[model samples]
Target: MTSSSFLLIGFIVYNLAFLMFVIAILGRKWAQDNPIEHTRKWGNYAIGATIIGLAGHAGFFFTRWYEAGHIPTSNMYEFMTFLGMMIIVAFIVVYFIYRAPVLGVFAVPIGIIIIGYASVFPKDVQPLIPALQSYWLKIHVTTAAFGEAFFAVGFAAGLMYLLRCVNFDSKEKGDRKEQRGVEVTIFSLVMIIAFVISIFGFNASGYHARFANDVLYTGKDGVEQTIKQNVDYVLPPIFKPFEGEQVEMKPFLGMTEAPFEAPSWMKGSNAGRKLNTVVWSIAGGLILYGLLRLIARKPLGAAISPLLKGIDLEDIDEISYRAIAIGYPIFTLGALIFAMIWAAEAWGRFWGWDPKEVWALIVFLYYAAYLHLRFSKGWQGKRSAWLAVIGFMVVMFTLVGVNLVIAGLHSYSGA
Candidate 1:
């Protein structure tokens, strides 16, 4: 009934669709048999569920628009969710054209992971800051996100292309390549899982670590002073302040700056903790990755390959390139052109060398290089696929990493 309800329904429906696609992939071989009609049934249901979820996601968007009296692209949660929606949209478009249900195995999960990533951010709607109060908020941010969504799908396709196309026969170079690729993918999945754990931990603990005005802290000079901080859901200081201290006065762990008392430039006091948490998660993931390999005694990538034996890797590789080709100009227009316009209006400059802007340029330029290398240099198979993979990581850093680590002009407060 309410927008929140619609949003929940959308999340649940999309997750259900995600599972269906996974099922379709697992049962695809069975569905091809004349006697048993299962994969088709699951595939159709997945597609239908995906469409319904999109509608529900749209409902959430519209409801937020109505509630906020503006488009919902002004913050992390809204824009990130929109990005996830666009990935599914891109997948659907490709599906209609190619009829490749195999892509859905990777495509839907990519969207789900993105959506899951977005869910970890603060979800409450808040008034837009003065910088974001413009028509460009919708036009620029939505278009940029839509374009990057295609790129995200590009990453999925590229990964699929690599997994499906690589030669993995024992005692061969292909096997070695697949082993390395699988490690990277599995490591990525483990990082995601760790992030999910952090979110779950926060919710289960009802975590709210903040500092109101006049909060006491020892400055870098070791002098106790009253300060203001807006930290939320942050890990407590690794080394707490002495008894009777309201805030940790310790400023550094060796040369590294301590994860407290966010710098004045940061948009959120909690940014340090969020960034630290991510680093810890990745480090933990690496340990798990090593452990998994030790236990399994083989490369995870090669292990997963047999499940997708019938997949057409060439189709995936082509589609990966196509996704980038289709999305590049749009990304250029929205992320670069319109973004510059918005920056000029908001910050009195066309380009500020902001971290986010720099990363956006990096993503664009990397993909451009991928295109040139693919067409002009004829770097088609593994090399091009690897480029696509890297391009999406750059894009993701622009989207998520810039917010958490380098606050810049972008407001990640309560994000």
Candidate 2:
């Protein structure tokens, strides 16, 4: 099959499995009727399916890399795909220890949403600019993406805990409270899922719609001129269009004239930009369906559990702590130490106060505060949960915000 065909198939299979898992939770039935047995069976199936999906996703990614001849993460599309895969890998590791498949139901959809976002970008295998031609590109980007994936998982777990806590404490009591909690949880999940999907769909559709309008008005004669005009107006100096021949531009200030040619490698893969809109719409729809199932069940945590079997809240909490513990050091090394080294190598200085750099520092500080509040002040439960949520926000800022809003030295690469 074609690479795009393979990706489409993978997207369908993964999301379908995710939906089944959600149904299992909401129906209060797993592979069997009993909670432990049900959880064990369903959890295994979910993780197993995720593992298979990850393999397929990785295959798609490597295929793109081979075609592109460089890393696959030179733009937002590739970056989001890579991040989604990383989140699945992290989920698998956490699942084994926590044995909570419920987390996967929440986490996987978010990964899917990110991949949907990636689909918004043209799937062309564009070439690396001169600035992105260094070894640090691989190290810096891979580490940053890994950190973002971990942060995303952390966010999922926090949300799940919050939902579960609300159900447990609701004053209504009994079946009524349980029913109400389930409704509320499902509503929240659906709303969040819809919003994310909409963003991805809107962004992809908007770009293509605008491009189509431009083409209609400009016609074939103005195609080249239109490309040049759009490149001049829309692209930042760092991301100026590539023509075939070399044109002199200040690398530090960004591109002036477009490059003479797009790298030879990018030629056939530029699939019409509108294709992304179709792909995102389908992926986003599946994600929304899975979330709707989660919503319909209401009181997700309580419905699935008569008693909080095998999994302890404290244990789940500790698992999160451990994940943060392991991730924190690696994140620090990559975001702070390695990023600075790369900046110095690229820009002739270690720090430039770029938006990306500032956000990276902000993420670092946020996590540091998380650790401090947890250990020094002896905070836990809701307090720590709130901190974890905030830390993930910082990570998101470093990931999407840095790439999209605050253009900087690292902005040219993947989010």
Candidate 3:
């Protein structure tokens, strides 16, 4: 089968599995009269479908690798695709340990979401740059992805723990309106949906916001980049910066003589484009959240909690910690060690403290602290779970944000 065909099949299978898990979550009461047993069976059914999806994903992976004559882990599309698969791998491992049915409900959807997010980025399989044309490419990227996948699972478990345990009752904290875990869950969904929407909208409309002024800024490679004013891009700048060239320009509405000026430090590409993306995301997210709230007539977290009521919180906590513990060493070896070694060969230096490297260190240290606190200071349960959640956030920021910002030595992503 063609690689595209394989990927299409994989997408369908995973979405099917995701649907089944959702059904299993919501239909537990109607399944077999016993809630726990029925959901477990439903979760298993989802897993069965997930296994089939995984096979298709593997087919897609190998086919792409063969067609490209290299490991398919270079670009955002490739790495994110592999990362989705890793989440499934981590799910299988955790399931084997605790046999938690709730995990399938959470994990399968996560895989689907990840793969879906990956589809938004550029999908071309370009030839590797000189720096990435090494055997270390396979080792570093693959291992780092695997480690991050485990961390993703830990995030899932940690989130589930909070969703299951936290009371949904409203409480005021100081002068601000305090939100519950379920509310936060909705916010997260909004953000994800927003991101997807922004991606699609920008790509589909080919909308480009015009910059008001030409500006000179340094790129990640430390080269001065001249962004001429009155250029069109997808994003708009959030705030105007005083730096850069201030050339006179006509406004879109013929309102001003000078073009808009924004600092390059704000984002990777055009500041106006980045800003446009964020605005689109926020607008899209808020709309989706409002619809969900209207349809469910309750906070999403509150709605999901009952489905997970019978799940053992202790099991969730344990599995989350185990995932991090196992993943930490692997992440350390691959993302840091292998990464540094590869950097040394490529740039003739070990570490340059690039944005990517800094974020990598941040991810590693966050998890390291999590372990230290969990083991030495006895911070498990809620505390450890929160740490896992934050650690995964750091991992994600490194994954998506770094690539988007075009930071560090990982310029191969754009290649």
Candidate 4:
């Protein structure tokens, strides 16, 4: 099937799986009260459906890459698709390690949201720009994106664990409190995710507007003659012609022409930037709400079921630590080492303090601090959770904010 067709099919399947997850969660109380034999059966079915949908999504991405003759991550649409795939892979790995499909209920929706965000960008197969014509582009971006995806799952689980921990003492209490707790947690999580996604959307849209305006007013000419004309018209006193007769002027007399035109590779960067602005704004609002709720000590209804109550916080913490342990070295190699090599090859400089690079360093440093806290001070529990939370923020900066806010040599890779 065509990639578009596959993508559509994948979207439908993913939505179906998402619905099943919601049903499974909503029916948790009924299953618990009724002692249904089919609970596990239905859960398995939902998981199978999710896996199938993920396969379809992977197929769609591979098809796109095959058609494009390179990685399909050179634009907003491609990056989002890749992110979705990475999230699923991470989810599967985590599920296998921890045997917790509950996390999937949180993670799959995030993948769906990423795919939905991708739909905002045009899906045309465009050629890679000169800046992206490097082997490291693939390695650096793919690995970093992979790390980000795993961290996203980590974030979801961490958030849930935090809520679960603060609200309940034991799994029994959590189970008893499941109904209200689950609903409240899900609601809060959704709100937070929505707010973050919306800000990105807004930022992307804003940048798109700015880029479009710049391109339109600049025209195809190398001269800023349009700007000069505006200056002449609006500020005649300052930009007045020399005190002489109206003589025919050279065509390129005004404005310092660029040695080269802006690369065609840059076409999507501004748009992505604008979208990120929107996403961040939305995220900011949700964060504010979450913080306020925390401060107010709002009592959300108990949502944990007896069976699902009281996660071994230590277990969850260990899972988070393992994820970082695996992800950190990979992230460092790809985002720092390989990225630097790519920069030197492409831009004649290894380090430019570009926003993307700065953010990568931030991610590395955050994790370094995490390790320091964990090992040096033997920190755990709340401190470790806080560190994990901070690590996710750094991951977000590396994944989304870096690409959107920073202008640099790697701009062509949609970052």
Q: Which predicted model would earn the best TM-score?
A: 1
TM-score of predicted model 2?
A: 0.70
| Residue pairs with backbone overlap in model 1 | none
**Candidate 4: lDDT of 106?**
67
Q: Could you tell me the C-alpha RMSD of candidate 3 in Å?
A: 4.7
- Greater lDDT among 1 and 2 belongs to 1
Candidate 3 ranges with C-alpha deviation above 4 Å: 32-37, 170-186, 201-261, 264-272
Candidate 4 structure quality by residue, lDDT tens digits, 1-415? 8787777787788778767765665566677765344444555676788788878888898899899999888887798888877877787777678765566666787777777667655678989888788888689888877877777676666655665555443456545454354444445445545554554554454421111122224456665432221111110011122221222222222422111222334343253333434444455556665665576464342333333452567777776776677677877887888888988898899899887788789888888888788888998775676567657766755655556555565565443
lDDT of each: 0.74, 0.62, 0.75, 0.63
Q: Looking at candidate 1, what is the lDDT of residue 270?
A: 54
* Root mean square deviation (Cα) for candidate 2: 11.1
* Tens-place lDDT digits, model 3, residues 122-203: 7777898888899999999889988998898898898888777776664556211223533665576567766776667666
RMSD, every candidate, angstroms: 5.6, 11.1, 4.7, 10.8
TM-score per candidate: 0.85, 0.70, 0.83, 0.70
| Candidate 4 deviant stretches above 4 angstroms | 21-28, 33-40, 167-310, 413-415
- Choose 1 or 4, whichever is better by lDDT: 1
- Give candidate 2 misplaced runs (Cα > 4 Å): 27-33, 167-228, 231-311, 413-415
